[model samples]
Target: MPRARGSGASAAAGGGGAGAGHGGGGRLSGAGPGGQKSARGTALPACLSVSAGCRSSARACREGGGRGLGRAVLPWPPLVASVGAGGGGGTRGWADTESVGKKRCVCLLTGAWLNGVMGRRLGKNKGALNELFSKAAGMLACIIRESAALTRDVLEQHFNDLKGTLKKLLDERLMSLLQEVDAIEQESIKPLDECQKLIEHGVSTADDLLREGESAVHGDVGQQNEKLCIFTKKALHIQLDSLPEVPSLVDVPCLSAQLDDCLLTILKNQIFRHGTVASRPPVQLEEFVEKPGGILVRWCKVDEDFIPQDYRLQYRKGTATHFEDVYIGSETEFVVLHIDPNVDYQFRVCARRDGRQEWSPWSIPQIGSTTLVPHEWTTGLEGYSLSSRRNIALRNDAQSCGVLYSKAPTYFCGQTLTFRIETVGQPDRRDSLGVCVEQQNGCDSLQRDKAVCISTNGAVFVNGKEMTNQLPAVTSGSTVTFDMEVVHLGTSSNEGGNFKLRVTISSNNREVVFDWVLDQCCGSLYFGCSFSYPGWKVLVF
Candidate 1:
């Protein structure tokens, strides 16, 4: 738009003179056009012909610059000439156009689509990974919790099993101890042969002494009576004939009374015999009577033959005090203290009543202990009552006198004999109630061998039979009472062997029913002997 400042041609030709100029055109420094004294070294052109818009000229400049000088006049110079035709000779560079704009549009579109697709895929993968990881975490937690619970259960089961094992071991140890104790007791009671040897030694030297003593006693009595003129003493001697016989004494009204008589005899005999001679004198330790109400012990008389005058009596334990006296008698009797409800006591009493001149021995130690009173006494009955008997009324009705259960009534062919015993009163259901069967094998009493019992709780199989076993439990209902018997399996017996069965149902000692049935199997279909329960009538009430 304006004239170019500091033209290169103008600057190059103005060597020494000022050219045609305005007032301040000549060298202002007053030196020359090329003055080194000017404030600025040179003035630069106001505008540059940068390659912003002129593409053809820029191409020509770039191409011509790569060639040799004078080769093809550059379009740059031609473009300058065209501008100079309008009084301006300069070139300008080209500016960016449509191609770059189209490139930018494509780049923006491709980058946006790629970023969206990749982001979605990455998001989906992350979500799936998180789900799987969460599930695994939950499963791991459940496993850990279950493992803890299982460990707890295992510990509890282990403790219970250990406890059971310990209990079983303890029970076995206790049974072994009991067996050892029984063996020791048996050994203690066995008689020693040494006692016989001791007796033989003493007896060998006593014949002459015993004979002289008997002779002197008879002469003294006969001579003394003549001097005193006490011929009436013969009646005193003969008065002994009036003494009650031994059997009569045993038949005394009560056991307590008989015991008292024996005690009196021991005391009286000790005074008389020990006063006469001392062959190992008798000395009593202590004796007394129980006061108030009690199951007191009393002295009882014994047979003269069984009495040992050298035996002395002593009492141990209880409120009884001490004393010294010889208890001499033909027989020995000593009493125990009385019994009371809920009381348990153990006491000892001894006698040297057998006058082998050795002090009499102590009696068997006895205990007065009562069981737990589970039921209250109703009416006058202090105990329950039970009894079982064959209905004689049925017998009178012209039925069979007795029916045989089998050849071996208590046999072992897996058979059962069920029978009932009737009882009186409502028995104590809470207490242990039942029946027992005892088998006696040739005894003066029916108390020898008792077989198994079928009790209220259930079946007991006792056998000399081949199949020996215990059975299950039995039950009872409320009735005054009834006989419930289950006899299973038969017993084995040799031909002609005697085996008696005694069945006893007891409610304490006061109320009881006892019966016996005798059976013999002699290879016959019919059992040889079958008897009704004995004493059934007395118990049935």
Candidate 2:
């Protein structure tokens, strides 16, 4: 028996070699007399066989002679088979074996070539792949970072907007609350403020009444004291009775709620309601005239049933806060004394009934002022007697024949001097009732050149010269009025302006007028009546 060759079994069998032909396996497997053949009727190729060992140089030579079946097994051309080979077993089998060996070598070379090419391509593309993946990762990281920043900014802006909105709402709410608080404060304090004002007014009025009573008592202890004491007591009693009652805390809410309405109602009641016999004040209190350092005030009651037992007069100087009182019993007119001259005064009056406790409201105020310069008598008139009270002037004797002048010169314009002659006894031509321009020296007389005089016998004289006209005749005990007016032709001055003396004399309803124009020497003048005999009586105003 032939020993089974390891790699050359099929080749040994196909070649019919003398040895066992299975020492080494060949590249292909072939059939033996008792060996199993492959299913395709072809020997297995050595390269495809799993049990085949690596080819050696000596076994290759042996297989190079046999015709193996590698050509049928593989798709490539048989590398070992020559075209010119004989069709004998030896040649054919050798060709088959060589072809199997060549096919195996080609497959190994192809595999190695594919592996080298793939390794070079993979080396070239390695950096590009790594760079693409790195850029994608960096882009993703950048996107994430930007997204986070945008989210943070959005959140911050949203928070800021929310904060501003909240602050504006809070500020508006705070302002509204402050305004409400102010309104509440004013409303709450209004009634208290009015009450405080009333208390202050009452205190001031009491102080004024006390001061007035003290002054009246101290000034005169007789009738003035008695009247002032009674008035003070009555006023105090009225104040006490009319005082507002203090409300308790329990009534605070109701009082505050109705404060204004209650006050208005009370005022209306006081003004319109007749609670007692005395209701309203004396109406139509008027200022009649200005006396010396005082004003005369008068009023009347229009109601027939209203009989006033006493009258209270209150006076105040211009814008003065306090008042001075003058209380009179059963009198409608009273003089507010000890006032300043040339100053304005306001006066109001109230009436008290005989048996009533309440006094009437004060009357409407009347305003008046004292004179700038009061009337007075002239001084040092020689040969004449002057009475300031009666406004009379009389000659000292029948033989008196001089000019009796006023102490102060009259205004050249806008002034009139009237003299009434009660008696012009013993009428003479030299007896005159007129005005004269006298010099400052005592020697200037009515007989001077700048004088105008009218005689009781209806004769007129100018500058000691007889005129052509005759005035109305004056008799004894017949009242005659002489009026003289001086007009300056230019600006008035004692030394420079021209003056005109207009004189009118009337007696028994008959009148006569005389006019004369004089020079600057007649500017400074005196008003008097010249008497040539005794028993001449005249009044000057």
Candidate 3:
């Protein structure tokens, strides 16, 4: 081995070291938290890396010394030991092992004086991530607030416009949606509230601990140990690795809003459609409004003199040839419930005669759709075609790259887009085989100038610039999901909320979450991804 100088740079540069040995201020290898050797301490290993530098950083990293924002796991390994263990670049005839050991010992002593000065700078980035997370939660709250308000205004304005057209009907539906909006806002903000309280309490506690430690340091020696105990216990309880889940768009999804506009428009044209009397059909599926769970269908009589004994409501599922009875009674308004979200359903109504007479004819078929938006991939590149109602994207040309983009009903707050890797044609042909983003569907590759993506090697790139966050690479047959929500609205007053999604990508059960904020404003965002090689099929939802 070469007798490299104890340059202090070799051991502390990275935190992937195996161990550290006796250097300056070095106690036993297994020193306790009190900086004292343990009763059963084992001797430190002799073979240490010669290239290690800056012992203070390395020591801080190993000890997890600093306290800020909150505690977190060391992203990499410890840096104190295993510097030149593999030996410097040279062929070694190990005839004089003792001499080499002696030289390494001398180098350790030379680097010992840098104990406090060097390693303190080690792993300076430890707590930065947690700090950013806390701050981002705050910022995201602001964005959600603005977006929710805008959404409320939009909804209110539409109903208010219809106030004169159908006062009773409009008012009832408007009030229901408004109430629901309030509930959604409250539920979404609940976790944020709890998180805020916890952070504030922690800050106050940390302040108290700091003051107590400072005073104790300056005052009585006997009190220091007690303070340490309190500090250690308190610090250990501040959990990391996860954040409280705040409500987003996907939680407790209900039937999506589907309006039978054609039917409603016809009803609106008839000035005398609503009356106490009945017609051939006896009832009309006149108006329908969206409820959180399903649509509310309302009908009325056509003539004041004619009366019906009772009414009946029936519905048919998507694309079926026959209609099934759902509700049967005299009620004019019925709330359809327990239906699949986002799917199309047909509803019809009729009435029975007054005196044990036969039932009236079925009303015109009214088409209604649910409100809940299912995950889907709408568009893709030339070599890719969408199947399963645009929910799956298949790459037919294995020789070329495949790219796909998600459609509307974009990821709102707390919504997730998942991709099942049904076919891993040739992941080895490309550096990235899974999810990515592009400015628009026009981009041919994920490495575009406006794209934000992670390479298969786990490097993050934004507009071609590499970032500090190193995500995990994807594997074959892995399920890749992207959870996105609105984090900010555009600067303009009328512009819709811009999406800067905080992403967490996981595959094969190894998940790592990191924030990759995309700066684009389109109210809703289109998710895009590109695969370098072909023969890959993705089922998106």
lDDT of each: 0.26, 0.48, 0.46
Clashes of 1: 48
lDDT of 1: 0.26
Worst 10 residues of 3 by lDDT: 70-79
Residue-level lDDT of model 1, residues 392-456, one tens digit each, is 11112222222212112222111111222332222221112222233232222111223323322
Better of 1 and 2 by TM-score: 2
Return the TM-score for each candidate structure.
0.17, 0.30, 0.29
What's model 2's TM-score?
A: 0.30
Candidate 3: tens digits of C-alpha lDDT, residues 199-307: 7776777787777667756766898888777767766775533455555677744434566779767867664453232213445554343322345555555434558
Q: Kindly list the per-residue Cα lDDT of model 2 for residues 101-143, writing each as its tens digit.
A: 1233211112222134212333554464344335534543554
- For model 3 the TM-score comes to 0.29
Order of quality (TM-score): 2, 3, 1
Candidate 3: global Cα-lDDT? 0.46
